[model samples]
Target: MKRSRFTEEQIIGILREQEAGVATSEVCRRHGVSSATFYKWKAKFGGMDVSEARRLKALEDENAKLKRMLADAMLDNVALKDLLGKKVVTPAARREAAAHLRSAYEMSERRACRVLGVDRASVRYQAARPGDGVLRDRLKALVQERRRFGYRRLHVLLRREGHAVNRKRVQRLYREEKLSVRRRGGRKRAMGTRRPLETPLGANQRWSLDFVSDQLTDGRRFRTREALSLVVDTSISGQRLARELDKLIARRSRSAVIVSDNGTEMTSRAILERTNRTGVAWHYVAPGRPQQNGFVESFNGRLRDECLNEEVFASTAGARTVIERSRTDYNHVRPSAHGGLTPEAVRLNLAASRLRNVTSCAGRPLPSAQQIGHQTLGLS
Candidate 1:
């Protein structure tokens, strides 16, 4: 059974009687309330005196008014449901529904009336196909290179890249190419999140890793793989450390953390477990966001443009030899915008300048790529 609210005067009277030693049962019966109700009122007024009760009366009245307002609001909602023909008890049925569809066809009343049931005179699709092959290729290239594009964004990009593509055609192309960013319907929540990291500074700081495919002349298709994991100290001009990567990082045990984005090989559980055991921290960048591991992606682009794309491998060993050599050149001669010096030159200077420096780089050292780059009898 539901109980009703007791007024401040009623509470004061009840408390006064109970304090004067009148039995609670006798007082409750006289007041026409249950003993439970009387005790409840006692608890409410037990600590407060008459002055405090008078002071809080306005607050109690305001609370009552607010509760009425809430009930009225709920009633208005129910009345709206009746007015809207939604008497269904299912809350799911009461929920608002919305669907989003965009028609970006380049068509007239004659065409659109065929595609959609609407009259052509009421249509807004373009009449002619914006047949710009060059523009399409450019957009596709940019999308591939950047790995992201939506209709509006692609429109802006095309405009900047000298393509006079309109938003409708861009939308059409985006849908056709499936390049539009996927959208999901839900309430959006605010979350504080970090952005993608760019190139890192400092040796042994960030190493980017990824794999790429290549082919041999004997019709053998294989992946031309690379682990361009360079930890350049950005403070020290983010120098590229080029050398035999195997010699430098291949050894077991005793090092700082090495991070890689998951690319099958990098995601190997063995690598994860081993790193854990060896006390070398391993971090995997989230998938699809290569800029999260920008160094490796940048390195992959260079490897393709400079080495793999330019040459056809005779065999895996020959390919390896060439790749190793190219890496040496990349390390020693190619001035990294991040790393000011060649990998070889940096390593040499590091050894000479600092004590207790160690890398497993040792061999019959070939002539430096720096020497090759600026040759006078193969030396300056």
Candidate 2:
């Protein structure tokens, strides 16, 4: 609800003017109110003087205060009942309450325990879980590395890595260290569902492309314009984009499909001609639906959060150097969700697998040119 700007006395004065022979429309105009608002005010404060309106305002405020007090009192009563009769106190809570009572009332620890109905030994006991600094540091590092993984998955990974820790303890440390993943909330009506992109069966089968924008130290804005090929174009255009694609295709095998957003560069005649010349398919995401190009979008997010935001690029050369280094780390050094292998490692593994498949086929002819093009490769 929108709050009214006028005070109670001001509202009553405006209503009183309408009652004093001023035209209703004139009164509304003077007071900056609509006829509906004037009528509503008149209905509420009609026949009341300034003193009477003041008294009525006081009564309304008092009523609100009383309602709040009543609510708080009821909540207190419930809490007291739970503490005395119904609730089961956990060890942590028991210790916390006992310590509070002992300090606040200057009571002995034994007396505090007796009053709280908790054992003195339990109150004095300290948990041995997540005991050492090394364990906490490792947990922190894991959480930083895997931002999306919650306590359960983190616990599983820790166990796999031979960390003898309990899930509940991991969860407790996760809360205490505040390592929970904070996912961005989207619009309620925004498209939430994404059709999964067809996963390629071999290397060079498919590629995803997306652009990420950022600014340098001198306030000059630049976009990291190409992925997969690892080219960072200063300007975004069809010619620039097509040239990068040509370079990538010349170096690596032509991918079957290049997935991208419906950007002007991707749709331009130059890009279209290049794709046609290379005999590769271009698949565009729906307009305004970036999530449809999820792989590249995810890469763009990491590029911004981990690299671009961390660097102060003084010039195009500096920007390129930083971005290229980060891209290398992303593709070759950083472990991906694909069984903890880097993207380069995964691609190499897939290529090796394809090679073995061909070798095992002895008499069969190797895959044709078109079939080779069907193998996947990507840039984002």
Candidate 3:
């Protein structure tokens, strides 16, 4: 019912004015009300005081509230009867139940949803995500090729292929596809005081050398010497080691220091002569302490785990080819810990930054384009 504009006290005062012999038309005109409305007010509150009128309003409010409660109880009872023995746990299931109630029982959506305990928004929700068929296919192919790669590495590969995907999305898809790499148990070692190794600030500033060995199909053994700064050379003798060292120095420029374990080839007179000729300091770790050259040791561990254990080479030539391809990927394709960039990309970026610093000194004029080109070639 619509509420009256005049308060109960004001109505009583108006009635008293009428009782005091004021004209009815004058009273209605003074209050800006119609005669019909005045008459209705008179019929309802003619003899009642302000207190009685307030009490009547309070009773009316309580009665309306009770009616609403009764109606809700009836709705819940009917819904329970309709949904007997049916489980509605998920939002989807609740939405389905509400939809069934609306269609089968001619119930309104608001009432049906209230009874089924579902949000109206959820009932109207529709999935609008794009399909991932192509992405899933590509992800599976990468997993097949690099069986030991984790989702983080796979995410980097996908980005390299121009996929514009998020790492979390790749992780979700990886879990959904069950492509997790199983971790192998490690051997226990003697506990000792651990010290963190200092990281090199630039490429070719420090290099580490280590040999990784594997067997051919006929059980013949071969070894590959890996330079932890992204160079690998296959050699079987100390003489070949010296030649490879010279080739590495010529190709990659001289390093300030070379770190290695105290193996015979690394400590040989030929290697010492080569280092002296190139003016490169060769630092040897203590005997039986491979952890002193941790960088190359870590690389050898990964090479053994990810490549050597997975491949069975039939000949030395095939082994060299496969190892060379792996080295290329390690430098140019595989992601490193350096902000997800490959080793080659990191090296190029560092070199470019250094060249910019050299050519753009604060008080000096910019170098010519020819000089810049020469610097670029030298850095490369």
- Span of ten consecutive residues with least summed lDDT in model 1: 371-380
RMSD for all candidates, in order, please: 24.2, 23.3, 12.1
lDDT of 2 by residue, 1-380 (tens): 35669877888778778778999989888878899888888888888888898899889889989998897556545434545653346788888776666665566887667666777889999887445677788899987775666787677677778988888988978887989767554334337667775655555667787667777677777777124554554577888888877777778757788888887878999988987787899999877677776666666666666676567888878777777787676666655555555567666665676687876655644433222322222222
Q: Write the per-residue lDDT of candidate 1 for residues 1-380, one digit (tens) a residue.
A: 24456668778878899889999888988888898877777777787878888778668778989998897556445434443554433222222110001222222334333422344333443337546677667778767743433556556657766776688987866666777544323333333443555332223433434455667888776554123332211111101111222335564212354556665555555555555555656667665555555455555566666566667778777776777676666665554432344455555554464455334333333223222121100000
Error of 3 at 40 (Å): 54
lDDT of 1 at 165: 66
Which portions of model 3 show Cα errors greater than 4 Å?
1-126, 186-190, 225-235, 359-380
Please identify model 1 stretches exceeding 4 Å from their true place. 1-202, 225-255, 338-340, 347-380
Point to the candidate with the largest TM-score: 3
Which candidate, 1 or 3, would have the higher lDDT against the true structure? 3
| Predicted candidate 3 versus true structure: per-residue lDDT over 126-203, tens digit per residue | 868888889999999999999888999999999989998999999989987999988865545445555455554345
Model 1 lDDT, residue 213, Cα: 64
RMSD of model 2, in Å? 23.3
Error of 2 at 241 (Å): 1.1
Give the per-residue Cα lDDT of candidate 1 at 332: 57
